[model samples]
Target: MTLKKGIVYALLIASVVACSEKNGTEHPDTATPVATVIESEKLKFTIDTLTDKLDNPWGMAFLPDGRILVTEKKGEIRIIKDGKLLDEKIENVPAVYDHGQGGLLDIALHPDYTTNGWIYLSYAKPGEGGGGTTIARTKLNGNAFIEFKELFSAQPFVDSEVHFGSRIVFDGKGHIFFSSGERGTKENAQNLGNHLGKVLRLNEDGTVPTDNPFVNKAGAKPEIWSYGHRNPQGLVYNITTGELWDVEHGPKGGDELNKVEAGKNYGWPVITYGINYDGTPITDITKKDGMEQPVWYWVPSIATCGMAQVISDIYPNWKNNFLVGALAQTHISRVEVDNGKYVKHERLLEKVGRVRMVKQGPDGYIYIATQSPGMIVKIVPAN
Candidate 1:
């Protein structure tokens, strides 16, 4: 009996050796497995390029049929279908200002898109004298935008083309929220009289909601939801909590993430952690009694551009987390929030190019839009 047991043990040791040696041998039929490097100790995913020919694509939305609509900064909307960029640009898009930081920007679909076919866009539009951020609603009908109407535009358009804080999002409660930058003028952020540097909430057809905080205030723009923002390019609505969140660019440092609430002052130039671009001090304070503070602020800024929340069943680890697109640092920031408070964050997809937008598709895959050699990449489980 002892001899039999010894033979069994010897065979078990030999089997282990054979498995370990397999790594050193070349198996021609077995393809080399792709390796994944962990980042920030929180995110583990693989980026697969869906298309790389986009020209500085700024934003993208997935169609129900699995195609994608991408907006190029040069005032064109390109479609990606069947893993190939379509030859023709979508027709009847608004004429974009297309200068400086202004141009074709964010895009979103209605929550009932499967039934209503409503598509919303935010862009820099040519106004009477200069240009400003504008929101337009249109219907997508066979490669063209039909029945398009300008839904909202920032008041007193500025001639300068920079700092168009244009991002569009919808809360489930029958309202739309959009942001507008101060157009390189910091004082406009503090003034309640102008729509610049403020987030505006509107009904689907451009009318200001009566419930807006500034609606009853004399001399204030009734559409104003929250004010005192810088160049905010990222806005998203958290469906689970029914709250809106946004990220904005800072001067030299102090990029910020704020939980947007109605009728609140975000304290831009008056209270900031950033210095001017010329290395001058913008403010001596970072806090005050009447102003709202950011949930998180990044010193030595990353120049964050776009944001999206991950609520995918496929990525259980990343569920309910927010993904921020870092343009200057060329990475995606995974931020975790606990009970509406910022808990922790980590950077992901470092050096993949300037991440212009990060979105979660309806099919549970995270999509990233990169600038420079513009491309759309999808993130999935490394498997």
Candidate 2:
């Protein structure tokens, strides 16, 4: 059954409305509704509405015990348990700037979370010059935080509220990697003195690793692993291949999917496929001698946010594909990559609302977080 785009939109809207109604008043754990059935090139699947109770959800982390912790842009951490949104927000969350693009952001659990009990968060932290991206870790005690520690704060905090690139991933080697945007200053992406506009590597305890790319480089922040990025809101580390990937926003066009590498420079304003937001060219060149090119890029700017790769076998047809959240386009991009190169892509769940995050749950199902009528939806194999 070939599902037309129009039918998919209608079914998605109806399902969203129905799901909202079911969770609006009582917030009960109702059976998830089949939002829509999608027939892709390889397999058919159904999207199920898990919950519609979030507000501007930015990121999510699935717990080992089947619970999920979600971060809202307004500095709240929410929990979804037994397919229901818990009314009580997690207590003792750090204060966030919550202006423009800054706010509570991505969350991830430590690889040894089951044993160490550390949960990590990246957010826009309020400070002197203004708020900037910060990474912290804490342990949850019931619905509250305990033993909270500030891990890494992006240096020279500025007042700009937009372009706080942030995402967290573990490389399974006792090291963590996170990204920070240029904080609206394009030039900062190329500067080595500041933490902004860079992918940073740190030990689990917030210390810079000795082997980080810039560790011994004078005049550079030791945490920097790669430089020259815009607002990179997505970061994922492939454990099997040890490759790190990032998806970042471009000004007008040229949203990029990068195979991020340590010590490499990803050209941003210096060389972009995009022009300035006001229709002026930032640079006429898209290639530079020493800068790295993107593995894939979007011409019309999808406002890429969170991303995750398919490694589980639950959806064999979607194996090894990347799922990127499309904010401006309001869909999820299923990108097929072959040996570090782009092959083909498809847009899934169109018009479902602004997608903020797409993640694969511990159960091997794909989960998506969207805003407007904030909700979490799941894609499972159609029976």
TM-score of each: 0.89, 0.94
The TM-score leader among the candidates is 2
- The residue-by-residue lDDT of candidate 2 on 1-383, one tens digit each, is 12122212343334432442432344435334654567767767777766776789999999998988999999999899888888788999999999999999999999999999999999999999999899999999988999999988999899997999889999999999999999999999999999989999999999988999888989999999999999999899999999999999999999999999999999988999998889989999999999999999999999999899999899888899999998999988999999999999988877877889989888988898988758888887887
Which runs in model 1 stand beyond 4 Å of their true positions? 1-40
23-77, model 1: which lDDT tens digit per residue?
A: 3453221112233434346445554555656788987888899888999988999
Best by lDDT: 2
Query: Which pairs clash inside model 1?
Result: none
Clashing pairs in 2: 165-181
Off by over 4 Å in 2: 1-17, 20-32
* Every candidate's lDDT: 0.82, 0.88
Looking at model 2, which ten-residue stretch has the lowest summed lDDT? 1-10
Give candidate 2's error at residue 169 in angstroms. 0.1
